[model samples]
Target: MPTIVHTIRRGWVYSPFTCEYCGHEDQGAIHMKVGASAQVGILQDYDDTRDLAMGTAHGNMEQAGDELIALSPCPACGKRDELAVKSFYAKAKPWIGSGALFLVVGLAGAGYLASEGEPEMGLLATSPLLLIGLVVLIAGLGKRLRKLPPSAVFRSRNPEPWAHLGPERASQ
Candidate 1:
C-alpha cells in the first residue's frame, strides 16, 4: 500500500503596479505573502493538487491587489480610475473557436467515411474529436455566462490610503 502525505508551504509574491489615475508607480511594490498546500502521492493526482494550491495562492493575491487598488484613491489625484480586467468573452473566444473547428472537421470526416462504407472506422477515429469538441464547447459557453465584477470601484464607506506614497509625500 502507498501512503500519501500532504505538505503546506508558505511563499510571497511581489507585485508592482502603477496608479491608473495619477500614473504613480510603487518603487518597493506590494508584497503578498500566502500559503499553499499540496499532497504527495505516487500518481498524477499529486501534480493536480500542487497546481491547484499554487493557483489558489496566486488567485488570492490577485484579488487582494485588485481590491486594494479599488479601495484606495490615487494620492496625487484623490480619485480612482477604471482597471482593465479581461472579460469572459475575451478569454473564452479561443477555446470556443477551436471547439467549433474540431466539431466541423469531425463531422465532415465522418460523413465522408460513411459514403465510403467505412463509417465505423471513421466514428472510432472521430469520436474522440467529437467528444472533446462537445466538452470544450460546453465549457466555453459556461464561461461566457459567468458574470465578473467590474475591474475597479470606489469604496466611499471605508477609504484607505494608497499603499505606496512617494518619499516626498510620505514625509508630509
Candidate 2:
C-alpha cells in the first residue's frame, strides 16, 4: 500500500491603508494556509498538490486581506470609521429603489383590475410580483438599518506589521 503525504502552503497578503478618521497610515495583513495530499511514490502528484495548495493559499489570502483592511480599526485611533457601512448601504440603494417601483406597479395594476370587476383574477396575477417586491424591499431596508458599533470592528493584536508577504514573493 502506498503511503499518502500531505503538503501545505502558507501565504500572507499585506495592504497599506490610511485611516478614514485620523488620516494615519497603517498596514494590514491576512494569513492563509492550504493543504493537499498525494501518494508518497508519485512525484508528479506531489507537484500537483503543491500547485493546488499554493493557488488556494493565494486566493484566500487576497480575499481575507481585503476584508481585514475594510473592517479593521486604525491602530493609532483604535476606532473604526463608517466608510464600510456607508458603502454597503450605497450598493443596496439601487435594489431598494427597484423593489419599491415593482411594489407600486403591482398594487396599481391589481387595483385597476379589481375596479373593472375582476378582483380574483387581478389578485392571482399580481400576488407573486407583490410578494417578491415586498421581500426584497424589506431585506434591503433591514440591511441599511443594521448598525455597526466601534466594538464590532476587528481589533487585531498586530494591525501594523513591519514586514509582510507580497504577491510576487509568495512561497510554494
Candidate 3:
C-alpha cells in the first residue's frame, strides 16, 4: 500500500471585544475554520499557530504543556473568561468555487457543441468531467457548513496548538 499525503493551509480567526461592565477591551470571539480533516488531526503543529500566539501575548510568554495561551486575563479587569466564538466555519472556497466553475465551463462547452449539431458528442465529451466537478463542489460545501470548531476547545485545559478546540460543549 502507498502512503498518501497532501499539504493544507489552515488558520483560526479571532475578533476583539469589550467587557460592558468594566470598559475592558479583549478578544470577544474566536472563529476557527473546521472540517473533516480536523476531526482526526492536530492543529497546533501548524506555523500559523505561532503567529496567532505572538499577536495575543504581552510579556514573558512561553508554551506551557504543549499548548499556547491564546486567551489571557484582560489587562484592566483581571478576569479570565472564555471568549465567545463569533462563528464556526471552514474554508471551502477552493473546492466549492473551483467545482462550480468547472461545471459551468464544461456545460457551456457541451452546449456549444450541441448547438453545432453534434449533440451526442457534446454529452460524451463533458459529462464525466462535469460530474466529477459537481461532486467535489458539493462535498466541499458540506464540509464547510457542517464541521465547525468549538469555543470550549481545550485539551488538558490547554489552548489547542492549531486552535481547533474540539466539539461544542453542552450548554449549562
For each candidate in the order shown, give its overall lDDT on alpha carbons. 0.60, 0.66, 0.49
Tens digits of per-residue lDDT, candidate 1, 17-85, equal 467766875422234566555555666576677777777767777666554444444545655445433
Model 2 RMSD vs true structure: 7.8
Segments of candidate 2 deviating more than 4 angstroms: 1-12, 31-64, 146-172
Q: Model 2, range 1-172, lDDT digits (tens) per residue?
A: 7665556667655666677888886556655455655554655566665566566656666765565566666778876657765674676787788789889989998999999999999999999889888988988888778664332222244533333434454221
- Best-to-worst order by lDDT is 2, 1, 3
Better of 1 and 3 by lDDT: 1
Better of 2 and 3 by TM-score: 2
Scored by lDDT, model 2 comes in at: 0.66
Off by over 4 Å in 1: 1-60, 67-88, 150-157, 160-172
Model 2 pairs whose backbones collide: none
Residue 88 of model 2: what lDDT? Answer: 49
